[model samples]
Target chain A: MTPEILSPAFGLVFDPYVLWVVAGSALFGLFVGAIPGLSATMATALLVPATFFMPPIPAIASMVTATAMAIFAGDIPSCLLRMPGTPASAAYTDEAYALTKKGQGELSLGAGLVFSVIGGLFGTFILILCAPLLAEFALRFSSFEYFWLTLLGLSCAVFIASGDKLKGVISLLIGLLVATVGLDNPAGHPRFTFGLPELMGGAELIPIMVGMFAVSEVMRSSISVAAPLETAQTAIGNVFRGMWGLLKKYPLQTLRGSVLGTLVGALPGAGADIAAWMSYAMSKKFSKEPEKFGTGHIEGIVESGAANNSALAGAWIPAMVFGIPGDSITAIVIGVLYMKNLNPGPTLFVNNAASVYAVFLLFILANLLMLPFGWAAIKSFKQVLRLPRKALLPCILVFCILGAFAINNSVVGIAMMLAFGILAWLMEENGIPVAPAILGMVLGTLLEEHFITSMIKSDGNPLAFFDRPIAGTLAATMIALIVIPTLARLLVRKRPA
Target chain B: MKIGDTVLGALFALLGAIVLWHVRTFPVIPGQKFGAALFPGVIAAGLVVCGILLSVRGLRQADGGGRTIAFDEWARDPVVVVRFLSVPAGLLFYILTSNFLGFHIAASVAMLGWLLVFGVRLLPAVALAICFPALMHLAFYKLLRVPLPWGLLEKVVFPS
Candidate 1:
């Protein structure tokens, strides 16, 4: 929080080398984002080791810039090729693709780009004004409260289940089981390592993430090769033509998407994909032409794309204020912070307030910088579709392999990535939702640790969870989330047909 | 879908049983009633409940002649399965050969092989296979000062 910290960050940003690093990272992010299998989390994870040698401001700037660009670039492929560049774009892929088919591809791309920047800027403003207050509130949480928080995060699996609730819960349980591997907490006993030293620390996040998102996606892409790649025949037209119309027509949708995206981003385990879906669903319900949604709606593209990008900024809030990660990408960012010997949590703001503020400033700057870069990127990415898949897939595979290998330089990690890739493929083939499983793996350890510690502190008091007001509220919220949906369904069924 | 759900549900039930049984081995401290296994055990119970629900739902759907699972669609797409399986297969080969082949050689080979399997062409594949690892090596080893496995190649290239 000292002026010294802020001064160093400001000076660093002005440094020629730091600016180059930020720009390079953003460009790299745009490249990866344009590719269907590559994602923001994977790109961030791949770049994390490279930042080990950088100064704090440069390192943070690179990550923030990359994340923002990656999210924005995701819309490129979704708009042009019907392939979601990132999972966040998955919610709007149908709508965006439909628009492209209708020769309104330029408008869809423009809407995605402009709203993404707007959402990113809005989230940054919120971070600047609200993070400190949230941090202060988070400081009140003790072990008991943390237990509820972790449970609350785990309960996100319910919301993740789009149609089949039971399947989602099952997937979550599998993720929790995977997390139970390695050394046991509290007692320091080994649980499921099976005497393998590589697993002593449990399944690393990087490999699992690479496998679930990148590898599984590649597998899915390999299928339907006959789906014939269609180059958008539409003109690139004026990028800003219909902006006034959209803003005037769907102001409420944009505001709702931005706010909901930010809130979801603040929650641990809930990332941009969830944010986009939630916004899309909300926008659909609020739409005057709700039935015309799936056909090709500009509001769908704006709301979902904006929500996803804003969620990126929202993610940094919890990560910077609390040591806990708000999502997988932030988890990787936390790793980079640890590598730099900068601890994240309440004390981070107190000890390094200026640098943190600089980081907030960088988020806004990065989003603003995205305008020109994203415009150029959209045009370039359309060209990328012309390249033979025969050539592009291999290059992507190389990057994926190296990216996996670079983390820890352990062969075991690479092998783990491949193994999980196969498992992910099988799961997808079987119709299992991979998102909840990944969320489970991410939250599993935290949930277990908190549950054990809270029990120990209470000396066997199960009611200790309800004893604390915050804990009780969180627990109640989790229960309500589960019950409300079932109740609604029942009420609908009971209604006259 | 019915068969798949039944199998999955049974698998979850088995997992729950295993967790519940395993927790018995850990000595529960006197004051602390719950042991290290308690939390996992609770999650396991939840899994069992969910699994049961899935199995029941799947069976009911099947009995009602609901939407059937498409086994033919999955069978038709063998490349998807291969591409998926090849990642782990390639990684295993990389890990097994990294020491003898050296990090750079092993990684380059792995990358090349993965590209071929993924249907990438020869020239760009070869170029990327070499450049990506070389760049990573320079960044991690030379710039960041993190030591990567040099293996037998390092002694010949940069003998101390």
Candidate 2:
């Protein structure tokens, strides 16, 4: 609130160079996210090398702007082609596509854009208000707390994933297994590496992600490659139209989604994808008409879309505060923070208050800019779908190849992508959800590291896990979530009907 | 595959057992009782229990017919099979030949093959195959400064 904090950031943030960086990165993100097989994370991954040349504030702004725009642009393909442009959009792809098929494409696309801006702004406000206090609180977190947090995120995967819970659990285990494939861990001993020197570093997450989402999608699209992608509506008239009415109708859902998305997103391991999935599930669970979810209901999309964008802002809270990434994107951002000499942690607030505030300002700017840029991207990209997916698929394949290779500048990355692509295809073919596996892959290392560190610190005392109050509360929540469901089923069976 | 729950459950249970057995060979740190294998072991245990539960439930369910692998209607079509195989083949082609053929040449060949097998006509396929790689070379090599393999073109571009 002080002018001193604002003064230095005002000059840095408003510099034309920074603004241009933000704008250019935003466009890059939009294009990448609009493509069917590409994702926001891939956009961030590609930007890392380029970021080496830029200053800290611009580097940070590029990420904040691009990710927000990409998240919004992801909705474009999801609605038009039933192909989610990013994994964050996957949670509501069917709903958006169904609405498009029903000739309500404008409403779906509009709601995604407007609610995204609202939810993003809401999360930014929360980040501005709560980050300092939350960062103070996060300083007290130990490996025990983080272990429970990772478990909670893992549970969110099961709770939110569609279809059978058992299948979801299996998919998660597969991801966790993949996480175990490298040499580095708490033990510093390689397991399941199968002697490939490249495997020593562990499964490269980008390739795995690109493989799971992009490559598997390509394999599935193969079934209908010849069939032209058709849409019930052609012109996207007044995308901003009806968004206000829908927002008014579901004000609570919007607030609920934004709040939940931010909270889940602020958690150390859970990211925007989990936030969207959990919000979508919670929206259905609490809706007046719960059964309306999957068969193309905008109700779920509205809530989840808002949730995912808010989650983006929420993620930076922990990254800025604790240097522990709230998600994968922030994980990369943290490295950039250190490289830029803006080290994260409590002292960072005192040492570099202006740079920190500049980051906050950039978040607000990025969300606001999404309104115009998102509209333009949506309008133009709709026309480009005239090209058959047969041609489009090859372009995506090349992007995937380049994206996977660009991550490590190695062909091993490409091989990993193709191998995982096949594995993910088989898993999906067996009715297993891919999202939980993705979550597992991301969290698996953190989970192991926390668990081992906590156990060693406690000298193998299992009781120590519940001794700490915050850890105890999280553990209690975890136990109740598992136990209460079985207890409710038992109680219902015994009662009588 | 629309695998029967019992079969899927058995598969998972077997996977769990294999992991559990594998953990026995993992080297535990001397001072710590738990190590890298402990987490995987716990997950394996959960997988086994869940797998058993799923299998039992599947066995109890009535009318378990047609619960095995069942291909979609599109799977019967030859074109679909070729289209499906084309993507993986393109990836494999790149992996095996990218260094020898270079990124541009390999990607063009892969892109062209994918476009054709997926039903794009030869003319458009040829156009995209050639144009796309050039665009990629500009962006990745020139813009980003990534040293994509030049292969045969290496001698002409950077003479030894």
Candidate 3:
């Protein structure tokens, strides 16, 4: 926060190389996010191999810029074709499409663009103000506290993030098991290498992520590859019109969405999609015209659009301070953070203070860049949609091949990608949520490391986990999160009977 | 494939049993009870319990069709099935052949197969299949220095 550190951070982010990376990533993100089935997480996963060659700041810059633009650009397809480009857009898709049907498409698209920028900037402000303070507090934590925090995060993934709780647990266990496939444990006992040298180094995160997010999505898209994409509105005109009036009309809703979105985004496991969904519901619940929600109303769009984009920045809070991902996108990011030797934790903030400020600066720049870039994306909606899925999907598959291969520069990476791709496709087919599994994969080793360290420190006493004050509170919260919902459900069932 | 919860649960439970049994022989930390096996052991046990719960829940549901496996509507269409299967088939083709055929040849053939199977016009499919890999070569091989294998084209590409 000092002027000295701030100046260097500004220098880092404003470099010509970093700006070029940011600009290139913004366009790449918009293209990927505007296309249906190419999720924001997939954009991050596919960008990993490219970032592998980049310096830490540019690598971080590319992902930050791409994801911010991608989230906003996702609004384009939802508004035009009624097909949400990413799950975050799914919440307000019907409302946006309804606006298009009612000839208020520009209004809907305008609110999405405007509110998203507002929310993103708002979230970045919070990040700048809060991350350093949290990092300072986090410095006092012991392994016990970290263990509870990681467990709390994993619990949130299962309880709050997924629809089917049982399936979510299963998916998470699968990821944790996969994470145990190396000789890097405390005892250095090769548990699951199966005599392979590559396995001893552990299952690579980049390849597995590409498989889970990108390859599985491609597989799902392949089934409906022949379905024609038809746009409801052929041309968009002046999406900025009426935006100011709407902002004046719904200032409260905009602030509420951004606030709630940031809070939810900060929570582990829950991300932009969940934030958008919850904020949209809250908007309808609080609005004077609740009945106008589904029928082309711009109010819900104003709130949730801002909410989703703000949630993007919100998710970064825990990621930077605790090394725990707030969403699947950040889950992929945590891996990159580790690869760049900028390991996430309180130590990161202390040691690489300049890098931390650079990230904050990048968030602000990316959000500001969204207005013009999103405008152009909406204006050229027809050309974006004209790329046939048949042609585009194969190209993506090739890209996936290269992305996976580039990680290890070996066919083994592609092999892992293929295997996990099929596994992920099957998991999704059976209603298992993949986000928890990914979070598990990202946090599993760290969780184990902390657990073992705490156990040894406490001489193998199970109750020592709650010995620390912060650890006890986190443990209590985790327990309540798991127990309260089930108890409520049971009580409701009994009353109904 | 839409597998019934009962079958999926049983598979997971069986897998957990295997993991637990296999981890039994792993030596513990000297003079300490817990070791490398402890974490995976707990996870395997959780998998077993969750699997059983899932199976019971699946059995209690009326919509499970009393079958271990079922095909969704898309799976019933043979053409759709081919398209669906082509994705993995294409990736597998690249994996088995990439090092031998080199990245360029292997990727082009795989891309061509996917494009054709997904019903792109032959002309455009052929064009994309060739051009996309070359573009990738410039990005990955030349620019990024990914060291993509050249296979039969190595002699022509490098002229070493």
Best by DockQ: 3
Clashes of 2: 0
If you score just chain A, what TM-score does every candidate get? 0.88, 0.78, 0.98
Regions of model 3 farther than 4 Å from truth? B155-160
In terms of docking quality, model 2 is medium
What are the candidates' individual DockQ scores? 0.46, 0.63, 0.85
- Model 1 reaches what TM-score against the true structure? 0.88
Clash pairs detected, candidate 3:
none
Taking all chains together, the TM-score of candidate 2 against the true structure is 0.83
At residue B14, give the lDDT of candidate 2.
91
- Rate residue A364 of model 3 by lDDT: 95
- Model 3 per-residue lDDT tens digits across residues B14-101: 8898999998988887898778899899999998999888888779879864247888899889999999999999999999998889
lDDT of 1 by residue, A264-287 (tens): 887766789889998999889988
Candidate 2 residue runs with Cα over 4 Å from true position:
A1-18, A28-67, A70-112, A160-163, A230-257, A260-308, A311-359, B65-67
* lDDT string, candidate 3, A1-497, tens digits: 79989999999999999999999999999999999989999999999989988999999999999999899888989998898989899999999999999998899999999999999999899888888999999999999999999998998899888889999999999989998889978889997988978788899989999999999999999999899889898767898988889999999999999998898888888899999999999999999999998999999999999999999999999999999998889999999999999999999998999999999999999999999998988888788788889898998889999999888788989999999999999999899988889888888998999998998999889999888888899899988998999999999999968
Best lDDT goes to which candidate?
A: 3
lDDT of 1 by residue, B88-111 (tens): 666677778887888788878877
